[model samples]
Target: PEHFLITLALPAETEVVWVEDFYRGIGDCLDMFGGFLAGGETSGVPSGSAAVISIAATGSVQREHLILRSTARAGDALFVTGTLGGSIHGKHLDFTPRVEAAGWLVRNFKPSAMMDLSDGLGKDLPRLAKASGCGFSIDETAIPVTTGSTVAEAIGDGEDFELLFCLEESRADGLLQAWPFADLPLTRIGRMEEDGKEQALGGGWEHFRS
Candidate 1:
């Protein structure tokens, strides 16, 4: 990654200290993710409305390492990193990107397709299946649900920010046995099918819809 760019529309009553604190947090993230504080624009929004913050990044990836969601294959084993759901209980704003885990997996394993779980598994999984021209079968019991979340929430509650990926079923065992992160929980949630009978499920966080 090269730089981080953030654009903001703040309310009139917004405090300057809060902005500094936010930038400081971003700086901390940069230290972990490798990026610079490239400049951005800020403007005032009408009071009593809502404050908006938009972030964007510019980076370059090698053709081989640039994982794409549309490349998932039928019969591939689907996997996800860490527990899901319950982001509303403070994780939405306080979560780490799976940079280290993803980097290691991409370097050592051949994931057929990979993507971050931003729109909940129920939603994003179907999109991935559609793009790859496959149908997915999710094992609800296998989902690593958070402490206070249900299986449905784990599938539908958005903003998980974990890695959802797929690979050949043959490699699933080796990847699990060779996983190095003890604290991080990686689970094989389901598989892709050539004749997709399972329909696409529901999801959360429709930015413009709700």
Candidate 2:
């Protein structure tokens, strides 16, 4: 619910009107994020059956301001907001969505490409590269791992819920200087390469087993 709220802000004047869910926490989360609960349905499963819950949300965004994954280009700088890794330890539920930051970026810096890091950097970076038709080279030393979190975990643990974006290399310094959130750590992890090859020093969660 929180993530969806953040995504709605990418385009100008975006607002979430309603959310539907089978999870008990949905109402609380929607309320916390200032979204209307609208309505939803829930059902009980048979004995010994695994419980399943699903959430659906709807919102509107301005067409002119909409950001797309394929908008990245070579020579763009790659950035991630906030720390990563070990989210399962506590940060996952506690972390706040970067709605304001994302809106600021869209309105001011206008990143070439942007996405939220639901999957770990190692996995999602490659996907972003593929989407943009470019390659990326990230610095392992620059990745912001959370306290007590290993670099490997930062690369693969997922659930970071931070924003990952690419912007022209020239505008990076100005964006950093103008960043409003003093507490949030924005790190430049790497750059887009022309080769379109995908490479990462770390690994991330893979849902299916080989």
lDDT of 2: 0.79
The stretch of ten residues in a row with the least summed lDDT in candidate 2 is: 5-14
Candidate 2 per-residue C-alpha lDDT over 130-194 given as tens digits, one digit per residue, 9 for 90 to 100: 88999988888899999999989999899998999999999999998999899999999999988
RMSD of each: 1.3, 8.1
In TM-score terms, candidate 2 sits at: 0.83
Clashes of each: 0, 1
Tens digit per residue, CA lDDT, model 1, 1-210: 788789999999999999999999888889889988798899999998688999999988878888889999899999999999998687778787898999899899959999999989988888888888889898888999999988878888889999999999999999999999999999998999885655666566677884
CA shift at 7, candidate 2, in angstroms? 21
- Show the colliding residue pairs in model 1: none
C-alpha lDDT of all candidate models, in order: 0.88, 0.79
TM-score per prediction, in order, is: 0.95, 0.83
Q: Output the lDDT of residue 208, model 2.
A: 75
